[model samples]
Target chain A: MASETDYVTLISKDGFSYVVQRSSARISPVLKRMLDPTGAFLEAKDNTCILQDMPGIVLEKVCEYFYYNEKNKDARDVPEMDIPTELCLELLMASDYLDI
Target chain B: MSGRRGGNRIRGPQSALTDFLAANNISAAQIRDDYERRRQQAEQDAADAGEGPSNQTPEQNDDEALAAAAQAEEAEKKTKKRKRTEKDAIDKIKNAKATKKGKGKKKGKKDEEDDEDGDDDADYDDDFGMYKKARPAPGQFEHCDICNKRFTVTPYSKEGPDGGLLCTPCGKELSKDVKKEQKAATKSAGTGRKRRKVESDRLDGIAVGGAKSLSQLCIQKVAQHHDDIEELGDLPPSVLERLSEIFSKKRVMKSKTLPLFLRPDLDSVIVHDAAYLEEEDYRQIFAIVPNVRKLVLSNTCQLKDGAIDYMLERCHDLRHIQLYAANLVSEGMWHRVFREAGGKLECLKLSWLDAAFEDLVVQDMVKYCPKLERLKLKLCRRLGEDAVTSISDLPELKHLSLQISQNVSTPVLVNLVEKRGSGLQTLSLEKFIDADDSVVGAIHDNCIQLSKLRLSENDTVTDAGYTALFTDWDNPPLKFADFNSTRDIDNNNSGGPEDAIGLASSGFRALMEHSGASLRHLHIASCRHIELSAFMDVFNGAQNYPALEYINMSFCNRADTSVVAGIFKSCPALKQLVAFGCFDVQDVVVPRNVALIGVPRAQDAIEQFGIGIGVDEAISRMVEVTT
Candidate 1:
């Protein structure tokens, strides 16, 4: 039911971009503050964010996880979301920085 | 490559520096050999030149000397180059592999490498580097500095004075000695603070006018000064008064401090706790202050017949006498004191009499003390229905507190209320378990001037009685009301449905609706059978208790968080809400102006939002979860 205006664009360091819904993006507190309507940031004005420290591979995994969490948020029995073992430490560090 | 560096000397792969050195074919031994060969060739050249020196002239001798100086300079430059190369090799060995091995293993490897390079003392110069420092070899025996005992030393050995080594036992003992000295210093400092605290506590105990019991104060004073204080006569009158309070609170008012409290000029003497004063002490008080008008004594077990007679004979103008736990005073003594000295007495309070006081004493008091304005009899078990009925005859009585006297029947109580209830302002009948509907009806019919009523711990007074009492009642709204622990008695022997006693739902609603505007303190704790729906309906936003300041509803488990929240919204002037043992009440927000106690989960809600939230917002948040 969401229109295209409800989506935001996130670009990684290597110029890889992903589009996510506003509700899903708000799950991360950092993204929520950036995209807040009361804020004066460029991200809030243009509905776009750029993360300089995150690589394209790690940003792709983070975007996938946001969607996965949104789907299972109200489910009584949720299925586990799989992540590659080598990417765990980097994902943990990135999530800590994002305050998800 | 392994054989070129000798046998198994380097454990891991060679570093870039070692590889470069090996690639250049510059070994330590080869450099040394070149240096020696050059030195020997120089010596041979010098010897051959010297062989022809004897055949030269003076000019040739000077030229030979100049040539020799030039040769010596060249040799010195060669030796310097060789020394620089040797220093570079030693530096590489020390810096490259220092991190790979332990210190002991590295020392062993260095010794082996020194022998291989044929440089016996080269390692001494290498010790000047930052990474390496020479130390005494491990497992070397040394004497302890304190005990002079020889023991094997390790890297963990403690250093003593003058850089001597101490054995393990001596080091432990020395540290323990230092700790003991520090502990003693701290203990002395702590004792100073403790002494100051005790002095302040004693002063605080005096200022509060006996907050602690008399025996506890006595023990504290005795512990402070082990010996008795004998002389207190020179103290000023105000100081004597304070000392009397201290001695009375300490319960040590014996013969020593008896003279301090007595003077002929003083007209009134009040010993707040007279449990320790013996018979002779009472005689002394009477003998000293014969014109004393107001005398109050608590714990009068030591006052016998002779003491009472002496007081009645000597202090004839005594207008007020209050006695507590005066069981030793006989009925004959009471009759005599009332008949003789009860003409001008305006206040008489006797409490905690086991069996000595009876109906005859009450009759004598009512007959003799015609001008009495206040009469209180508390916990006097032997005073029965006749005795309580006789109190209705006092013409000017105003305050009466009859507590825990179970034998006074309902008819006698109704009779007393009918006779003198209009003049009574404060009536405390706490633990009157036998009071029922008739007594409530009589109070409703007559007691219109009541300002404070305490009917706590009465299990027989039912809801029907309370309902009838509050319905269309004409009395003024009570300022203080206590119905705490007034529940139905669950008779286990009769297996039928339990008859609910005490106040019920509609009765409580009527009481609150009648008195809600002026009630300042209301305690209805442990009234379990009051239905939860009735509680919520009565305390909803439609009903307002504007003057209510303090309320206690502990152990009323059915009133959950929503009911408490509704009470908060309804009572505008509420300041304290106590909800102990109400387990279902959780996460209820309290307003900043009010203090909430004993609601366990409300503490977390307060911590989360702090005391800044508005009342309407808190009520709305609390209601959202319940619905």
Candidate 2:
């Protein structure tokens, strides 16, 4: 299934909205945990406030990666995303902040 | 004020609170005496209660009750003793306030004095703070966060389950776990480690120490000094950040003593000090860096047995290898090296390994390195007919040098000619002893692109062989199968050439009629004899092949100065000539256009001509010969 068809919606802090599939958002464990407290209808308003360093494009891609892999989690390991050098730095810092 | 007292009671130690007040120079002796009196009155009350006989004169119950009431009154008096004390609390507070005011005034005066002193005290305080912030000395470490122990390293590690300052040892252990996990991840993802090998013939000829044992010892040493191998340690923050930026570009330099045979990119590396490496050292070096392309391992005697497999497994980009002194390895060295490094190798130099003279080693080398263009085995006595025959299959081979290797026979050279043919551009078989007619025939028949043919010190080559070899087959259009008819073909411009043909068609006979004039540099020095008919072939030719650049005919007794003079006249394009110790060539016959050099200077001239440079040690010799 397409990542967009799986997740219903993804709202970014910069006010950019993504009507994504549920499976796409579940790609990342952090996003999955975030959805745990707030179900499908709950707004992931924290992306605007919590993730200080994650850029819009990276967040979108990360969400897309998670959405696709969520359905086949048992069969496949997490895909190693070949991120650009600058974004890798950003991810490390951001992940460290989230205590991931 | 009530809360302040409670705060003071909690903050200050009980003994220190009393001591601080007393040592302030305030008089509190009366309070102390009043407390002591109250303590004695309590002791008397306790004794009266224990024994009623002491107050028998009074009504027993009434007396006891009165005594109790009296004791209570005394306790009340002691409890209320602070109110009656002459040391008034108001007076004490006034005195403390006055002293505090005095101290404040003293501090203000000191401040004015400090300003007059150029504010040195203020600057000193700030400097002290800055000095503390900056690292003052090695021992004065900023305390660790995890262990709370004063360590040189600052707090960076995450708190363990048991919260303590993370020390260096703990950090190292954590990092090792991270690395091991990383390796496991990669491995689980189906990526495996690689190995490398060195392409050298077995060095059993030199009888060096055991290859297997030596390598094991080297690995033992590496294991023993494993802690010392600190490729990854506590790097400074800036350096660590930079390293993580381009993690793929990281290179590992094991050591100068250890030669890595198995590396991923083994082909492109040039190792200068891996000559005496043991096998274990070779394995260790290969275990890390697996892929390289251009390898130059000079000494092979020091490497151990299974190390070659390491090179083969790891290095995919390997191409050229310049090996020096590879004669100290065990037997089956070539088989191992070829099994690993055979296909991709194009250029190889094994000139310095004089002890690698085994026949099977040479055959195995030829079986591998099929695309070899340049094969230099100079002075390697172990090289025999097998080595030459093995190379015959290599179609792309251009240069073949077996100089001073006594084991190489004439038949081997013949085989090379028959197989490689016109592809053989440069052939150096100098100082060969058993060069017969079959050898000469091979050169005559197959060496069409033969520019430089050095057939030095072979006594078997006669005058007939000389004339048969030197005559150009392509230019003169003369086939020397009929030696008599071809000899006259140069003489008669008028004759039906088909009718004039006589002798049998032999490749050796063609050499006697001077059928190889396309030859540039000919080293026929120290030959046995040269036929008179061969001498005529040189004189008869006016227009020689344009490519014949250099010629060496030193120490030929049969041909005289006439041979040299004839060469000068016929081959006008000859640039260099060596005729030393020939005794046949007169000094007057020396050509001014061609430089004259001794036997040793020939190599120098060739080097200059090959590279098209003017650096020549032979130039001096030419000048001296002219002067």
Candidate 3:
């Protein structure tokens, strides 16, 4: 199960789409719940979360954080995750929704 | 120099300051007197020249000041001489020390006298280590305080150690130290902010100690930027709920940020603080999230009848409504919401309702809301014995959590529990201080499906009553059990009489024996009578509590390290063990996974070393800890 990585597409508001490992995307509880096979959500059926309200620029950072959070979940004294000041507020709301 | 207010940023290197002074045999007082004399001479000479001497005092350093002061006295002769060389001087100043041999041409006047002073012109350049400043005004030519070479002055000149200025070359060298100090100051400021957050998180129980998890750090960042957030896109309700909590705690849930929580597809709109929200904002919540089934708002001081009516009119899927401190909503408006929309409502929790919700309001809730599964009416001032009687009529009420101000007897509560307890999953009756043993007997007989039970703050129920409630009862083991502050309140006898009242040894042991396997969160915060032996026996290595995670045995005075260590031995899944006021506890080494709280004497050592180590290592480190 650990050897194979499932991929999912995250589409942003400005028609920007990012393909990321499914496990990394599941770092967000909202995404995990939405994409759970047992649950009947459109995003799960298509293996995609529309990310309807997020801009592409913000969505890119969200994808980065998904991997960053997953990579450093158990790590200590890690370097601070860099955030662009201009998009901090947007990413903050997104992160709250994602619960990453 | 200990940051003296007037002190320059770049001083001569510390050893250099003393070395130059000692070698020159110069006292600070003597430097000050000589500097004072030069300044006074310049002023007096300016007065004599009337309009001012063309040969200006350049406000030079200690040694140069004396020479400049002497030049000021001979200003009349130099003015005529400067007129002849003015064109050449302008060209020289413009070249800015490029004419390296300008010092040779200028040697006839000042260099002859400066050479007499010897090493006085040799020191004080740390940065450029080339052109030290002699406080020359812009467009003037002063000798570089370091090499004693001539250089033109500008505003960019850096100050030297002996109250002079350094030229550009020396200025660049001095700034390296300033840059390092700036970097260190910013780094410490960042750490200071992080330390404060950790301290507050420790107090809030968000961080269990040690470092915070990565998600916690991200989530906290999200809370801080709440105002800037336009909307949260399709977040899980749990995270949304937590965001609301964090926002409310941070006092950021205002009119501007409230709109971020509302979405058309969302089934719930929870705002933990509506203190800053007006009636219009409440209407916006209903208008935006029309499908909201679970709407929770606290500190709704401005939620009047108009907004409640709007919510009922627009939100057709409204089922669970919990509003706290909605004192502005009248008794009549609550009636309208319950009567009009209560048919679909399954849960209704109204707390801190000081103004309106009376016994009639609860009666209205019981009468209208037929599908109500969970009902909590706490601190509603008018709720009394009659309200309890009214609540007994609800047909499907499974979860009942109430904190009424009135002294309700055992029978009224017993009647409610017996009528509804068979199908009940959660039953919490808080601060019913007048309730006696019969209510426990009634629950023991009727409540078979109870997963959570809290009958707290009543001193009349003895340990025997609690033991009876758990022993041989057909009810499944409770997932949550809170018997906090149930002890007999007596100032005269601190330990209580021999026949221990409230939850004591026998009752507590029975609770663990029954629920220990399934119990996840247990709060016996002030159950003072539960003896040390009972705690030891329950947590002994012979019995393992597989699912138990969080246990609060605060004020259970007899619980020492032995019992605490036994708990560690028994409950492998335990994460946080809070024992506030457990004074006897001492020198207890906690394992990596568990957070030991409120054992005051041992907290510092635990915070330092108790987090992030295995059980075997912790056991090895465990000393003769309070035998």
Best by lDDT: 3
Stretches > 4 Å off in candidate 2: A1-100, B1-310, B352-357, B366-399, B402-432, B442-452, B469-519, B528-548, B557-575, B582-595, B598-627
Tell how far residue B396 is off in model 1, in angstroms: 1.6
Residue B8 CA displacement from its true place in model 1, Å: 75
The DockQ for candidate 1, computed on C-alphas, is 0.01
Candidate 3 off by > 4 Å = A1-82, A86-99, B1-196, B209-215, B233-237, B602-609, B624-627
- For residues B383-412, could you state the per-residue lDDT of candidate 3 as single tens digits? 899999999999998889999997887889
lDDT of 1: 0.70
- How are the candidates ranked when ordered by lDDT, highest leading? 3, 1, 2
Residue range B85-147, candidate 2, lDDT tens digits: 312332332234335443544443444343444433333333233222232233333454444
Return the lDDT, model 1, position B622.
Answer: 76
Q: Quick one: best DockQ, which candidate?
A: 3
Please report how far candidate 2 places residue B420 from its true position, in Å. 4.6
Give the lowest summed-lDDT range of ten residues in model 3 chain B: B122-131
Question: What DockQ does model 2 achieve?
Answer: 0.02
Q: Which sequence of candidate numbers ranks them by TM-score, best first?
A: 3, 1, 2
Name the top TM-score candidate.
Answer: 3
